[model samples]
Target chain A: MTLDTRTTVRARTATITLTGDVDAASASVLDEAIAAAAVSSPRRLVLDLNAVDYLSSAGLRCLVFAHQRLGRGVEIVLAGAHPDVAETVRLAGFDRVATIEDQVGG
Target chain B: MTAHRLVVDGLGAPSRLVAGFVSALAACAGLPPRQAYRLRLATDEITTNIAVHGYRDRGGPVDLRGRVEPEVVRVCIEDEAPPFDPTGHDPAPRVAAGPTAVLGGYGLFLALRSVDHFAYVHVGGRNRTTLCVLRCAAGG
Candidate 1:
């Protein structure tokens, strides 16, 4: 699966837009993106997964890694997650570590 | 109920194969969107586990068998690797206070939570996991 990530920082928030499937092989790309976004020390991180069709456990680990890397002060938001991805996030208890939104701006 | 089987390389990208197979099965079974998604999620988790944990990503043959019944869709994944039962394992703690908290085990945990029924067995040097998801009318 292909994973494309684009990051834009506005103010203290970094928005990372991801498209394609996030599985074991492709999770590293997301990790690098999260690391890059964390470098600016943005107070908030928004991951847009509206276009991500599939998310696996390996992908979820990348989110956990992001939460750990950004620390507690940084608010991590998962936006526009597909239904399956949302369910996996919830089941993995990611909701406790980060905020989940229906859309990026919504 | 008709059963379908698929064998894929455990070390390669199994997600696409799993998605296609599960999507077809879900469609043939008339599963709603939500149920179909759950099946796909559960299958992905188990297959990934087999590839990562069981085969250590070295590549092995993983067999998947699935069937759609009237009320539930059932799937079984079999791998001829070391015997490991995920059903008996507990999920990672929901609350991690710090970065040091262990992040492993969520794969099986999410797989368990996503399926309506989950079971594990070892027979003839094969590790088999069976998962079932109930079909709902509301499509959720």
Candidate 2:
């Protein structure tokens, strides 16, 4: 499937929803969203990964990049991650780095 | 004594599908959560590198070979792309406090820390990367 990325701002939060597979090929698209989100400097960043059936390490790099660039005080919430995808993130020790919701479709 | 193989191409979406599958396999084999995550992470980094930079945009297919033992799991990734050694890559630059420190550019660094063993080589005009993980004992 083709990759899709959409960003919306609610209050001081920015929600970026991703669909399709986020791998090396699609990381650039994510990079753009991350850059755009950085500009807003939202207090909270919510990554909606319900539609993201797949998340690669490259994808994880983007998330980490987001986490690093956002710095302290900014909260990154990952919502609606696929079972395997969520497990991948958790295994990467990302759960410790950010907030990971156990449930999907939020 | 069984070996599992997964073959993927650099087409449509990305190769994370391959990583997710391998991650599940590693978990089922009783690898620790952190270790499993690292395995998945390393697999993603090397495979994606081959897909993105290996074929010079003319990617073909990559072979993922997994051998899960009682005490350890071994992964051998073979690709016909460039002869890139993941181990030989330079360390990631430290991120300093300021706008100059970007968020990206730490893939190899993370991979290095995620696994206990790493070896890469160029063989038969393909990039072969081998990674191993030791099963952690309970409460250790």
Candidate 3:
């Protein structure tokens, strides 16, 4: 239920790594991490979801807000989502705004 | 015919526990991963809406009952939050193109779409949402 969020900015790219279940209680962590990433205005925002096991709609809504808050100029990429979680991303229409890749840093 | 029950005080963060309880029940019922996922999602979405929106910053209790029937697995979520049906239609964001699409009201919609059968009813100042997943012929 606890979501560990880490943000690293390098070479005009911001990578926010999340390691935990992303449910209603835990999604605020992701929201804050995305907020921190947006401050730097990175050209690319990569969310590393490889360690997350469950992603509820709350998390997806956070990503939608993050996408809007970061503006259209920033490229959003969701990296290393498990097949089930990836399917969730596709389920909420997140794939329309962000590139969901199976591999990170690829 | 395995049955499980969980009750959470939605005044605080209740979604994680509710979701975990459903997941464990699904495993106990021998539900397939896909069917289990859908039921969990539908249950989580409706209750979350109750806790977060219906009750707003303050709320009441939520009761969850999960049971495995002969042909399907079902979860009934009952909440004391103000009356509101989650099955109402919402125009979801268009996936075809444009970044203008918003995720608001999309949760309940996706929740309904994921489950095989869903029903919502308001009875005696309580809202109940039932979600069910059809078991495959081989018993998924």
Candidate 4:
């Protein structure tokens, strides 16, 4: 399936709301979005995965790219992850890298 | 136990979501959503590896032969790539996820780890990788 993302940067915080399945084939769309978000050097990067039905390892690799490219100063948060997606992230030992939240903050 | 088969030309996304075919077959085998997702994820990772690494030099045809067994559902992925033992690699990925962390090389680890069992063999000039997922704990 295809993945769609809506990224917005405000007040030095960047949020990328994703939808659809994030399989290997469709993960490149996510990579491009993260690249765009990185341009502004946002202090915090929030990947809202509430609408993501599936997250393959390719999607997780994109998270690694986010972490590695964003540098140590940035705080990367995975917000609103479904149980299955969250479990995969935890299984890959990525929870320690990015803070995972059930919902995006107000 | 009716078997299923699906063939895709390349590991292209959307049009040729190779794992989605396996997922559809797995769903028909009556696996739960979570298990089905894992099955799909495993297949996705393998196919991605084949596309990025194995078949990177040339285009090749990939096939999936799936069958529903009494205890588990199995999908054997067949390709013409060179001999690659997925089990040869360590299951745990070295992911520091830190400031100096170098990412990647998790495809084989994740693919083999997601499924209940996976076996690889080179026979008849084809690389056959079989992935099996348990139907249930106590049997269905």
Candidate 5:
């Protein structure tokens, strides 16, 4: 499966929409997108994971990397994660590092 | 029960194939959606570890075998690389507190937590790792 990432900036919040499986092969794609979004220096970074069907450890690592890179000033929110992905995040204890939401705006 | 073996190059591209293989096994074994997902997650993490860490810099063959029994789904991942015991490694910290918190090392942690039983053995100069997840469990 392929990973497609799109980042849009609105009112100091950069929302990244991701679709496809996030595994060892596709994690770099997400990392690069996160890096590009970080360059914008948004006040908040929101990741939309609703379309992500599979999230491997590599994907979780990328989220941690993003959390560290963005620093404490920028809030990181993982929005609309699939149940499986959300469970993995919870098991990995990543929910403490980033806010997880059932939906981006919900 | 007879185990089905699939040999693939220890590379990231083949992880998708492994996912499909395990998903089919989970369905045949009557695993619930959550349990099946956990099985898939464990399989993916282990295979990815072999591809990225076990066989790093030198590629080799990874043999994946699975069998669906009456009460459990067992999977064995065999690799002809240097012996690395996944079960021996310390799990990554559950919570990453600050910016300096390391990102890597979660692969093995997730792999171990998702399955009910995990074992590693080195025989005949091959590293064999077996993972078992309870079938039909209420919560995986």
Candidate 6:
């Protein structure tokens, strides 16, 4: 699994574009990316999953970490999650916790 | 009882490939898509559990045996590790205030939620978990 993360900060909003498979072996990269995006303490964190093909429990853990670290004011948005990963998030009831969109960008 | 066997090890291209295959087979065999995915996810979680905590990332071979019938799919996963039953295991304490508990045991919870029946037994120092899921359709 390859994880590529790029951050853009505009005003108080931060967007992190992540493209990769987020699974057990690959969650560390997600951890780092979330950490980097959180550094600016942005009010919003948009995670672009347009190219991500999968999400596992480990990946979910990484998201949970992001939620905890960012607190209430932070918005963790998952955009363009692949079918399988989206299904995982749905099945795990993460939709109640995060914002998921069909497309994501600036 | 229709039977099949599977083996898992390291160096596989995709980490969840085996899990997907297992789930796909169940889905094709008439299990509901959700149930099938659940069984496969359960297997993945246990096998991963073995590879992570039991084997400590120095992965070794894990064996899976399945008995599929018209009404149910019974799967037994065996690994060479100290005997442990995830069914009787306790879920890691919830942080409550922080992140959702990512520790462990959630897999077992998911397995229970996905399948109609489930159990685990340790035999000869191997962790053996039996998971049964009902087929949602008839004569499929």
List clashing residue pairs in candidate 1.
none
How well is each residue in B1-140 modelled by candidate 1, as lDDT tens digits? Answer: 97888899897668878888998899888888878877888898889889988899898999999998888889999999799998777565543442225567777777887788999999999999999988774446
Candidate 4, residues B7-119: lDDT per residue as tens digits?
76644542246655776787778888778877877887877777667787365777878899988989898888877778886546455343125456666666877888889
- Candidate 4 lDDT by residue in tens digits, A4-67: 9999999999999999888766888999999999999999999999999888777888988888
Taking the tens digit of each residue's C-alpha lDDT, what string does model 2 give over A71-99? 87898889988776786666555676678
Alpha carbon lDDT of each predicted model? 0.85, 0.73, 0.81, 0.80, 0.84, 0.70
Candidate 3: give the clashing pairs: none
lDDT score for residue A27 of model 2: 83
Per-prediction backbone clash count = 0, 0, 0, 0, 0, 0
Q: What tens-digit string does per-residue lDDT give for candidate 2 at B1-140?
A: 55778888754434557666677677668776656766776777767666667765576788888988878788898988757777776344442232124444345655665677888888888888888888783444
What lDDT is reached at residue B32 by model 3? 79
iRMSD of all candidate structures: 3.1, 5.9, 2.6, 3.3, 2.6, 4.4
The global Cα lDDT (0 to 1) of model 1 is 0.85
Model 1, span A1-105: residue lDDT tens: 589999999998999999998987688899999999999999999999999988887787888789888988898899999877887887666787789999997
| Deviating ranges (above 4 Å) for candidate 1 | B92-100, B137-139
> Per-residue lDDT tens digits of candidate 5, residues B20-104?
8887787678788888888888888888888878888367899989998878899999999889998888465434453237666
Best-performing candidate as measured by lDDT: 1
lDDT of 3 by residue, B43-129 (tens): 887778777787785878889998988888888989888787766654454433443465566567668777898998999888888
Q: Which candidate leads in TM-score?
A: 5
Provide the DockQ value for model 1.
0.54
Instruction: Give the Å error, residue A68, model 6.
Output: 4.1
TM-scores, each model vs. reference: 0.90, 0.65, 0.90, 0.91, 0.93, 0.74
Candidate numbers, best lDDT first, in rank order: 1, 5, 3, 4, 2, 6
Instruction: Tell me the DockQ of each model, to 2 decimals.
Output: 0.54, 0.26, 0.54, 0.51, 0.59, 0.28
For candidate 2, the lDDT comes to 0.73
Clashing pairs in 4: none
**lDDT per residue as tens, model 6, B1-140:** 56777787733222466555575567557666656666766666667777777677777767878877877887887887777777666453442222354544555445555556778777777777777777763432
Where is model 4 chain A poorest over a 10-residue stretch in terms of lDDT?
A19-28
